[model samples]
Target: MPSELVFCHPDGGIYGLQFPMSNSISQLDISTMKELSNFVNLLSRHKNLSSIDLEFHRKGDVRAQRIINHAFSLNVQQLTIACLFKKNKKYSHDERVAFPLSLSGSKTLEHLSLRGSCGLFDEEIVLTSAQRFSSLTTLLLHSITLYDGFLSMCPNLKNLTLFSYRMTGSPVLRISHPQLSNLTLEKGECFTHTVNGGRFHVSAPELASLHFFGFCPQMFTTGDGFPCLENAHLSFHSRLECISGSYAPTIVNLLQQFRNVKHLTLSMEIIERLNSSEELISHRPCPLANLKSLTLLPEVATFVQHKHTRVIMSPEVQKYLLSSSPKATLTEVLTLI
Candidate 1:
């Protein structure tokens, strides 16, 4: 028998095994019940672990919950769980895995990532008292349905990344944190459609960097603005036809929130949209006031001929963008698709 055993399939037969010279295994990637059992057995011999990554392909809610409980018991610092679903496969409500409530109160955990289709704070699970992740600092949630008050669980978080997040029970998504410094919001695989003029309200006084990609919300409000911000990157893409007049004002207003940023970057698509809205641009002053360096990125293209093409900003758009920050150095970056 080998020192370490791993079973990739649901059957009891072992497919692979490993023999370590010493008890120094710190990280594990588990997918099946047999693998999980071997992990539990290995834990008795080696008590110290750094991280655990778990992936589930089908219905294994009970096993998944048990794995999470065991990870917490071992005081694992980093945990990542992803529940993958097959294409065109329909699963019932009960088949969906619920986020284990037991791990919410973990104090040793520092990083947590949850991806794919999983239920978070579903109605089936109820909490009697408040739960807090006292030591968690970094959190990444992708392709998951989020409920209000989710951030309240992690009080000391410093970095947050939300990709394709779908909101439940409220149209408005509010993010307010005191110690948070970096925030990235990207419209990933599950872009939430704008309904009833959906919006985002962010209030992070200590924020230093901000990156927003894909379709922007109808309205983005940051109370008192990001006074401590130094870097900002804004890129907008839409599936529908680009209507300059439709998104011009919203983009302009969004830029105003980052007026204090010293380094700024804009995509070519944004420049084009602003160019067609000359009338609108003429009326409003430039949002950026003090920029150290401004960079323009080329739009992505699939054609072979357009791979290394240089992107040039029209004089009208350049003047409008650089009017307030005349001392800022301008640079256009060449991008290859």
Candidate 2:
């Protein structure tokens, strides 16, 4: 067996099986409550566990929560919990499980990732005051429904990655942190339609890097802008059917927020969208003023399809992108998927 045990759907029951414990075993991956119950005895023998990952396929189990609490009582520094129960089905408000607040009290935890169709805050568990994660510097939340005051709890957070997160009762998702240095947001179907009117407004003075993927939001503002930003990467999903007339202007306005970035990378979808708006490009100045290096990622396909085999950029598009930072070095990257 490997140092880490990944428990999925086992053919036979795990109750009578004896797991050989080694000092090198420092991580545990459990998917169900039954697996956790069987592994509970093993945790005591292996006291040096540094990471624990749990995934719930059905409902949240109190016994599983107890095991997780026990693991946190140890010196575990990293914890990842993905509640797969929220996948594909429409759950009633009462049926949703609130994230265990007890796990946030861990003193040694430096990285915590929570994902997969769970509610972070609800009526039962309201975050009235700050529940500080003093040692937490990195947090990744995906496919979660979050409220506004949640991020205020992590005071010393430096890196935050949010993928497919939905906000509750708020159209504007505000992220303002003094110690934050890197930020990433991957858009999802929840924020695709304009009817939702969802947007992001970030204010991170110390932020140095930013990565945004998928469709452009209705409005993306960086309070006064990131004064310390150095690198930025934007990869837009190619969904031309959803692309409206306002898409180009939205991209242009969003780019202006990162004018001071030294290194920037853009995807082929973005280049194509910008290229189609020649009249707009001719009127407005290039958004990046202090750019040092520009990297273009051209779309590529797998060996099965022989369609896109090369990077293509018209001279007009190149001139439009480098109008402000003419001296910046340009590089093209291609990846076969």
Model 1 lDDT tens row, 91-186: 455453333334446788898886765343221221222357888889888766666677778888889998766665566788888888999987
Q: What C-alpha lDDT values do all the predictions have?
A: 0.65, 0.66
TM agreement with the true structure for every prediction: 0.74, 0.70
Candidate 2, superposed: residue stretches over 4 Å from native? 1-49, 69-75, 86-103, 117-130, 191-197, 240-242, 276-284, 298-317, 332-336
Candidate number of the best lDDT: 2
Candidate 1: residue 159 Cα off by (Å): 0.9
